[model samples]
Target: MKKIISIYILLSFSFAYPVTLNELIDLAEKNSPVLKEKALDIKIKEVKKKQIHKKKFGEIHLFGSFNRFEDPRILYPITPPIDPRNLVGAKNQFITGISYSVPIFTGFEIEKNTEISILAKRVKEIEYLLTKNQLIYNIKSIYLKILSLQKQKKALISYKQSLIELYKNIQESVKVGKKPEVDLLKVDYQIESVEAEIEKVKNSIYALKSALKTIIGKKDINLSVIEDVRLTELDNFNRTQLLKNINSLDTLKQATLSEEISEKKVKIAQGKYLPKIYFTASAQRNMGNSEYKDLWQVGFIVEYTFFDFGRRKHEYIQSKLELKKAKLQKKTLRLKIIQKIDEALSEIKTAISKIKASEKQLLFAKEVEKIEKAKYEEGVSDLYDYLLAKSQRFLAESSYYQAIYEKESAISYLQYILEEFKNE
Candidate 1:
């Protein structure tokens, strides 16, 4: 038995460390698959930007070919059998060359393309931050819920103990012929009901703990021993100030960037109608039996689609339409975000009011329970009144606890909307 007790002590020590809310959020940020994917997307955009930058560097290619002809054709017709060999081409010939071309001008298309890539990369970064903030909010919400349930469990335990004591007292009174057997039975029934409720709460706690573990990506770790979380109060929140700061939100910034990118695309589409200038250079060698020649050339090339049946014009118009659409979408999103913030603020106010009312109700219920207990002991009240008082007190306490956590959850949601979690 001593050895078994020692082993149990060791196990307890191994699992005793309490995980905090911040630590859980850190774990979630480190392990979140969505954030990792967003990071990869940023890298992809960076690579695409590099590719666009490289477009101005032009391309170099080497070429080589060998050919054999059954009969070489003569470039000029000669009198019959008169120096036909002088006009005939070589039967076997080889040609090898290296060529390079660089774009000197692309009508601003490359510049616009690079800008678009830059905006795309910025968008991905904003998306990553958005995902992280959302994760933090989810973790905080779950943490608050678990804390509330734990508090409720404590209240239930205390109530259950009180019920047990009342049952024992009633049983003793019945034995002494002071209280009837039915009173003892009623108290016994209440005790059983409280026990059942305790069991139900324990099950709920287990399920919530499991959910917490999954969120933190630590399925093997026990979250049942996690430390209690403290709620943060946004005491100095001003709607005007927060609304002004809305532009700092990553979501809004992403939307704005997208609009700018669309405008740049319109410029790119317009550039398609302009001419392109390029510089090209090449060196070549040709060889055949008893003959060899070398040549080099460099030149400028200008290309223009001058007449593409109005294709470029149509594309430019399409891009312009897309830009307008992006602007409208951004404006709509801004309005929605403002509305959401207002809603969250209203919820916070409501929760604060609830907390106050529930606290007062809990105080009154406790006093009533005390008075009912005293009356029952003095034979001035029956089992039904005492049980009803106990139920009301428990309900009041539960409501108070729920209101506190609800306020916390509302604040968390408000912070989430304002991107305050990103600072953490």
Candidate 2:
């Protein structure tokens, strides 16, 4: 009977739990409109690349026409000897033919332009990943915040329980003339104060949870267990290593590809100054006497745009400038990433120190409370000392959670700058 009851309790606990972080991320990825837009951009660039390739593949034209004119010859009265009206009288005609042109070369611009679309697609993919990374960072921040509130709620409940028990004891003593009635009143007021604080913390937890639900596209997120690490983990952080990590992101990779694409653009632009060569073939059949016939011809055609008033020169210069700009942007981004890493590490250190000091103060306060309780029971201690001890403990616990949450925030910030938590 005992084993069955225990199993039932476990099942109930499982069913009542909130959704996890990974599940929320999965749902967001599936439904996020922003990500969908990025994916479509890739498709669009891919199609453009196909068009660029077709520039090399050549063009094929298949055309047909039919006419039955009522006015066979709208002839102006003219002289004999093949009069101009003879040309007009041949009005009823049918035409059908297939003509094709295959490009043999295009100054190598077709191949070079194709790289531009490829790079554009890559840049779009990187932006999408960066957006998703930002979302995950935000989600984790809220996630840890809810956990912090949970810890706070637990601490407040513990403090409130102790206050209530002490209050009950004082009330009994007052009834028996062993304690002052005013003392009972004082403890009762403290109880009310603690309850108010607990209510405030609860409300904050709800707000944070609500925001988190909107992010992960879900309403039921469980923040019961928040994994918090000590701040000492960042004491030996290497700035060089972190900067290297930032460059490892897909965004940085896209930046490099953009430079390469720009180089290709310059090549394509220079190609404009050269001549493009192509081969050609054409066939035509005409029937005016109700007789079928065929005519065929094949030859090579070369087209060279030899000059364009310095347009190609200006274009090549623009492409080179763009490539330089991309490199500068990459350098600026690296500097910013380095700054973020240093600041986050500093924050982690400060939180750790504060937490340690708070821990010591809490221990001292616990000892003071023990002494004050004994004196109060003997009627030698006043209400002030007791209230002060209780307040000290509450404040200490609150600070402890605050430090924890700050450390969590720092860790998350570092993870984002490093792209550690973001999927490639």
Instruction: State the lDDT at 70 in candidate 2.
Output: 67
Against the hidden reference, what TM-scores do the models get?
Answer: 0.88, 0.77
**Model 1 whole-model lDDT (C-alpha atoms):** 0.86
lDDT (Cα, 0-100) at 318 in candidate 1: 93
Clashes of each: 0, 0
Show where candidate 1 strays beyond 4 Å: 1-15, 73-93, 233-236, 287-292, 306-310
- lDDT by residue (1-424, candidate 1, tens digit) is 9999999988997878898988888888788777688789999999999999999899999999888878753322355668745654567878899999999999999888988999999999888888888888988998898889888889999998988888888888888999999887787888889889989988988988887777667788657577876666664469999899998788888999999999999889978878999999999887766566677889999998868887888899999999999999999999999998898888889988998999999999999999998998899988799899999999999999999999889888888998888757
Question: Model 1 Cα RMSD, Å?
Answer: 3.8
Give the Å shift of residue 199 in candidate 1.
3.7
Q: For candidate 2, give the lDDT of residue 296.
A: 66
Model 1 lDDT-worst window of ten:
72-81
Error of 1 at 18 (Å): 1.8
